[model samples]
Target: LGRWINPDPGGTIDGLNLFRMVSNNPLTLRDRSGLRGSGYIYVPFLSRDTVDIAIALYTQKYAVNKKPDIVVFSSRNEQLDFYEELKKRRSDFAAAMGKSLFEKYNTSDLSRKSLLNAGVKETEIKSTIMSIGNYLAINSMTLMNQQDDEIFSEISIGDKLKIIGHGSAGSAEISSGGLKSVTLSMHELAERLDFSGLPDQALQITLLPCQSGDELLEPVFIEGKSPFMRTRPSAAESLFYEMQARGYRRVTTAGYRGFGQIRGFLESTGSHHTQRKPNSITASDDIVRRRDAKEIFC
Candidate 1:
């Protein structure tokens, strides 16, 4: 699990790794009107197939303004392994998948025309188009794996939080002053930390293997639905509702997940590895937080 500031927050070309879940395009400009202020982006990695790496841009119409935050959670080693495999297969995979996607969803001509009208350089337009194709191919692959356990989960936030109460099993809460983080192990289970105290700031939350199971559990409140509640809120929804109750008006989440097995190959190829105590879960505070995409990608 990791989190970082989106170098291009609210920009159209952000969240490339999340190409699996969100279309590699900007949210409709019309929808942008309803945003009250900036929100935090949180990304979680629960399983290989359940990784949905995209930024969750939040805004409120009539609430206290707050800076956006980003959170990511995943099996670190597993995600790294999957990425290594993807890199090895990228060229072949892109070539095979790119054509079909391009033909079906290609907007190159329209995009080029728009860029030309906007006075963008020809080279930049070409580069952007190429990036679009790559993103389309990746999105196609993600759609194919929607049913697979190795795909990432889709997360969204909306106004109003409907809460009932916290469940008794596999739940924990960590609170410091008015800020709180919760871990819920139900329906695929997830861990979330709230930073209502810090406005317009970004922080990363990494969950180590040692932090898994009952040891990570703490008593916490779980929101429930009322008689009018027809749909169950997802983990993200529940967390957003909880945050709003704590006086936060905006939120966002984004990140990627692992897909293939390549860790062993990397290890054999002389990749540096870190050693940790057996079955020991590292405390959340001790986990290093990445500050930018460069650090994460490099």
Candidate 2:
């Protein structure tokens, strides 16, 4: 029953160590009396503790994340004949990060007196604690083209779109030149775009099996697509609606049910992977959307 998480945007770390869910409004912090009142500025004095965390700020006001030039994550179990649950979650996050790095060095020998007692300076605490210990090896990838279902992400298929509104992609790879490069790259990307990157229609969902158009080269299917009795919207919702109908702003890709995508992921309630949703059985244009997150463009 703990919370306050908020990290993992691109992931690096800042808000974690949860046990949240508090708000009765008494969580105060305000003071500003200037003029004839002489002077006052105080601020934030929230209190509540049977075991309250009450820390609105002051871990040096956090701001140190960004370490992913590229980290697709994958130990390879694309779920075809599996590696038994990614080898049991990579051996349980590597034995709970080696028992929390041996109780975090039992006492402390990080040298330079715990990096000036945490004020950090000793040459940036060995590159800031090995860069937040790299999210314990940022490992979690599963798309080896699932033996030809369909997926070929490199990103880029912009400039010709008719105006968002359509969907279809299926297979598990029996191959026909990977279904002619997934219908010759979606009919040369059924509309075209590439309007200056940043999420300008982030397309690339190819996994061939043959028939509609044939021509291949491996990747008939793997972890990208194959077993679809129904539902779809996984290529991050057609790369966020072909980059928000060609506008090029910020939020690059996020569709399948809006604001922050994939229902803002927060699972782990005994973790069996439910709560996903997003394939709303037909009726097109996301008929009012919901089942997760949305907003491929507008």
Indicate which candidate wins on TM-score. Answer: 1
Per-model TM against the reference: 0.26, 0.19
lDDT of 1: 0.29
Residue 156 of candidate 1: its Cα lDDT? Answer: 33
Candidate 2, which ten residues in sequence have the lowest lDDT sum?
A: 50-59
Write candidate 2's Cα lDDT for 46-115 as tens digits.
Answer: 1121001101111111112212121111122323223343356457545655655534543356642244
Q: Model 2, which residues run further than 4 Å from truth?
A: 1-118, 124-128, 139-296
lDDT of 1 at 280: 29
Error of 1 at 184 (Å): 5.1
Those runs of model 1 whose alpha carbons end farther than 4 Å from true positions after fitting are 1-42, 46-48, 51-75, 97-132, 135-191, 195-237, 244-298
What would the per-residue lDDT of candidate 1 be over residues 1-298, giving only the tens digit for each residue? 1222233332333332322112334343334424332222222333322222221111111111233322222345544554554465456545654565545435444552354345454554444444443343333232111122221233232221111112221133211111233333322222223321233122121221111112222344446833332233232333334545555443432111111111221122232112222232564332222111101110
Candidate 2 residue 204 Cα shift, in angstroms, is 16
